[model samples]
Target: MPNCHCFWSHIWNISGGVGEMGANMNSIIEEERVRGGVFKDINPEDEDQQPTVIESLCMNCYENGSTRLLFTKIPFFKEIIISSFTCPHCNWTNTEIQSAGRIQEQGVLYTLQVKTKEDMNREVVKSDSASTRIPQLDFEIPAFTQKGSLSTIEGLLDRAVAGLEQDQPIRKATDPAVAEKIEEFIERLKKLKKVEEEFTLIIDDPSGNSFIENPSAPQKDTALTVTHYKRTPEHNAVLGIEEEEDDRKPVNDLDTMRNEVLVFNTNCPECNAPANTNMKLVQIPHFKEVIIMATNCDSCRHRTNEVKSGGATEELGTRITLHLTDPSDMSRDLLKSETCSVLIPELEFELGMAALGGKFTTLEGLLKDIKDLIVSKNPFMCGDSSTADRAGKLELFGQKIDKIIAGEMDVHVILDDPAGNSYLQNVYAPDPDPEMKIEKYTRTFEQNEDLGLNDMKTEGYAEK
Candidate 1:
């Protein structure tokens, strides 16, 4: 085991690590970094950031190898275990990451477009619990089918090719016809790696821990789309969320409690203490019913609220464009659904739907939130002097938003929601608002695919 021991000392030993490992620790991050939009616990390295090593059997050769495990907390997120094993006899290696704590509050879906050669190099974090799909190929890798990977988009394709090719010899020996068809499909998969055609890569994670690197951060990238939504019952079941009997489940007595606040016992997200969450179903005058949730934690003095559309996703997408021409427009109440995206062409700004999370707020309040989220809280604009050009651009954008709030700027506020659940107030009441135009358009095939409707069979599924 002398070779095995030396190889591990080159990798697992932080105390007396090789120069290559030390160089990695000192490497500077060159990517354009932005803070505030992302919430991550860096888990800074300290004197005791070391892995526990143990001797284990290698899966490849059944020979003894050293396995190392490190338990790290993402904080407010879950505890995660990073484990790696290396076999000396076969020169084999295995690495995996596992969630050791609670599942996220909502599920996340990421859609990335691979249009160029550089796009294939983008990093991706594919959690074991996440599902991967490519719409063009009609290929799907179901959840838990593969170990969690810390790799680039190219690595994912390479792994897929390897898995398919591994069983080809057996398939050819037993069933040549089936093997021929598979071989053709395998060639198609290989051609995809050439970037000859543009394709979509999707990762759907019920646990909300998977991510595709956003090479352009703080600014929107046209090729990437991320959406977060409340997990469905089936998704919850898969995540082990619905298995436990809990009082936090939605109240079963909705009919009798309609117009009354229904309170549920839950834990505070911030403090992990006992708390009460109140939910009420309210009908908007021109819009559908929406559920409002408010939470209060006496132990930690933390209070928060969020809105959720009470209706199902509509058959078509809704696009509402409101021209701001008067100061009164700022007072209009707006319901921004979790699946809604907001855009202002005048400001050159757009807000995507992911984690858009339901918002019951006034036009003025929403504008202020946009300002605070992008400009006021931006790390580059706050104190980073190196990115003065980037900061100047953000500061100018904030000023224009302020002008719009004051009615000095006339801009078109567009809400494009595929779920068709958002609404903007009409001060004219019974009469049509002259300044607002609403359109309902059919969702495209791609939109339906992104929303998981392509695989859904809602009607006559039992008969099949």
Candidate 2:
């Protein structure tokens, strides 16, 4: 058997030589190999040549060697080298692939729906830094933790099944019931590879080094959809490119305080006792806004917090309305600025900025929070006859909100923001629903005057 260290050194030298010589050397090698009748023709001379394979030592065993290194160029992608090692003496084998390319700025995601045998035969290139997920099965192979491989869809599923079978947690599970469930999942994956079922395969690569080929649509691979997205802070950390933490002194350092306590000796609204209030000015850099947060009543154990924005006032008023249909819409992101108001006409409830203050929550979360608040304040509605009628209405409203959240009832949500700092997220872009309306209208005379819009007019200006 060949020495494992010597074989790896040779492999490194070959890779380094290819890097130094460029495509010219690759062409020469391809010509030489073809003339020697080594490999079959894979592409035209204008395209990249077929892969070159070299024998190497079996790292697993020193007695028997059956290792090979295959270097190939992926069409429209970078050069990749695949290494496979098999030990006849120990019956052990391993395969891995590495890409020789610069990291991409934007990450890529490929979503493919596999429904036929041809789909299973499609080529898949997964980088070690990429993650794979099957949404239907709720199974995921996390990124930066798996080996890179050049395989088919069927091969990928087989690998997943093998991985699940070898999983230590599932094997040594304390609950036999959980182990049985895992075993059942493994069987399902095996059946999926056999084309007995359909599944969606999602590959997310932060490095943007992975790919899946579509034979039918060779040029563009229209069978699979590709989406590019900016890498998150966590991805930056994983890639070791995170920015250094700021070490400079903060503007509001406690040592150089104008006042030790901004609003101290204030009486608690709940207990009517002398309470200390601490005020801190915070800046939200992303939104380009400043906020003042005050926490009061540490002494009476009746704490209350308030947030006020110090940003520039908005001139144009905006209103947003959304008709809730799918329960999935409840997960949409929401940002309620300090000057925004939320209204649910179905529930006959309107919360002004002064009432609910500013908050960031999902639609369902906002509804549940409001329901809980109403319940807390109207405890007497459950027992007092004087408030019984109002309590019944409130209870009915709560039930309707619940039904809406569960996708059983349809309702409308409206947000009015004079400051134009509030936002309603649209789950589908470029195809937004007509029912979800966002209108910008002229503010009333009192609203314009309050915001100093009236003072900006010329002397002879008149209402349009």
Candidate 3:
């Protein structure tokens, strides 16, 4: 099996070996020079500092000789190395490209309309991980399926044709009807390469490592349309920067845990009516976090429920699990933060942070609130026959909640607070309570990132 170098050398050799290969390389260099060539010298005045060009054994023709490797940089794009090999014996030639910059945060896509022959001269930097496509031709070259190349629009099309030619088995196995279609498609691509047709070329790179030069476009705008998109979690995993779990304890001030104030008259922020506000400072056992619960209400029926943290930023998150075995458990105080995620595994119902605001209530009150919210406000799930099946499931969930509240069914309540500000009554509290489990675990990198704590810096700046 001949390597890429051998394959390329075979190509040049078949067209006439060293003499022809030299002329081809020279033609490329001339074309580059005519179009304001991108390669630059770090120290042009000193011959000693001339661009470093190294020779190494060609992976494709190791038995023959070495290839040439040139290190250079282009304006806007930095630190790129080009590798080329031309075996004298086998007349095999090949070229490859690589970027020496740091990985990007998001992927990039470049779409260009090939309207003229000049467009074919536009430089393109395609990383090995990028995919190329010609939408008009219904053709695609998947990422990591082809060698990275520093080439022009024509070069890209040529590569595509080469790839198709290499897939002989697929073409041969195709039905007679489709085989002609394939041939026509290949011929159309060849014509496009020769600037005989206009088409659209799109390059999608999840690594944000590819480029399509637009030298003629204005400084603010380019002929190419560039689109950036967030990489999926799976893509991030491959980049070796997968978020780690946050594993730090909350900063709880035990000395501040004193319940002295009862209630204060205030104006409701919602209706600006006279209201009474109740406040309580309670300690979260084992988790070392303090929850400040506030409840406000007025005669106008305007109500407010909020929970604030009395401790420093916590490194680890908190999770509370409660088993409602008796009706008495319904009366237990529950301080849920706006950031807390509530789940009832037995009932197969869960409420995310976006579902509702924070609340200072009991387990039964929380369930009742959820039930009302789903039954009335969530018409998207209950109003139409399109969701008739889900409506039935929701009804069943409401019934389960009723049974649990009536102490007729056993159900488990779980609250996960990545902010570590939520609270649930502990079994070992100063006052005797039913058996409930409270577990604290470190938050994952993704969780901390979501909370805007991953990039938090506490030092090097004065307090305002």
Candidate 4:
């Protein structure tokens, strides 16, 4: 029998088996990223010493919020007009046909459609003429790209609030009518504050053919025209910064930083009454690297600090078996028949032969029989019917009758839930086995209540 055992092991050292350690390792990597918050892989300060011209990253520069300046030898009128700017961020393309005299005066049009990437695709001369034709040429420019904004803590919180509001239901969790009223209230609140910022580039094409070279000195060559546009935050809150506020915090003020530190009150082991404690001075096992500060209330002297972890298991340490079967009167013949191919939707199974005392010839044959049984019966069984139990025997049977035609077959499926602890195995399957014994621990019910001052709370939960 071929053995392919994939399990998660808490390795003391970094060296781990190829497939075995993958899932666990990924969890560790994700945890680090979250704790560190947003990180920039490239150093922004060291950009000056790097090469100025980049070919593959022309469109990418504008998309990433960087300005590109270009300079090239002109063919006509002391300076030739370039067609457009391609935004690497949003793929917005733009064109600015400047009269060499205008570019030197405006220092390159930072705003507007003609100078922006979008205007490049728009037709310039709305003419029914046969003589005028467009010209295309290449020019070189010095260009540089840099990230525009670094988000602050307040900005992150504001974004999180926006996200929360989107997922909020229109109706109350308990009362449908109340939920609708709350939703309406939220809509009104949105319109009143108008917290969201909008940015737009406007371009005017006079003669139509508007081509512009890079305006910034950094990227004069390849950073010429941007063809795409990316949505940018007009005002992003900078971290480690503070802003003046009114008596109450504004609804749309995502950039406002909070000055007060977060404080949590909990029961303390020694005394529970608003006492501050630090995690740095404690010693603990598996969670030594995790830092948590604890405090107690001044009145009760209760202390608590160990926050519960929230994530799916980094290591399931369990193996799940999936079985497929097919059975046809010409089963042996069908085994050789490659015409009908079985497709397991939403499932990928690892197959093996001789799992049960070598009862069947090929792995595929056994699976076909099982599938056949399933088709006949709404839910087929895995061979576990053993009266004189040595080990529960796997058994499956199927029957189908149409008019004078009758078809019947049997197949079996058996599995071991790693530690005999996976009680909710069927719930995890995309479409679980119907015959498998399962128990429910919760009943369905509903209720409605209202608190004064428009305060409300509603919840729903399920269990197996």
Cα-based lDDT for every prediction: 0.77, 0.68, 0.69, 0.28
Ranking by TM-score: 1, 3, 2, 4
Count of steric clashes across candidates, in order: 0, 0, 10, 85
Estimate TM-scores for all models. 0.46, 0.43, 0.45, 0.15
At residue 25, candidate 2 shows an lDDT of: 35
Stretches of candidate 1 above 4 Å error?
1-51, 70-80, 243-252, 255-464
Judge candidate 3 at residue 255 and give its lDDT.
Answer: 45
What is the total number of backbone clashes in candidate 3?
10
lDDT of 2 by residue, 106-150 (tens): 889999988888899777789988999999989899987778887
Quickly count the clashes in candidate 1: 0
User: Could you give me the TM-score of model 4 versus the true structure?
Assistant: 0.15
Model 2 is weakest, by summed lDDT over 10 consecutive residues, at 14-23
lDDT of 4 at 148: 15
TM for candidate 2 is 0.43
Model 2 error, position 370 (Å): 59
List ranges where model 3 is wrong by over 4 Å: 1-46, 49-55, 59-61, 167-178, 194-197, 237-464
lDDT of 4 by residue, 133-172 (tens): 1111111111111111112222222333464366466435
Per-residue lDDT value at 364 in model 4: 42
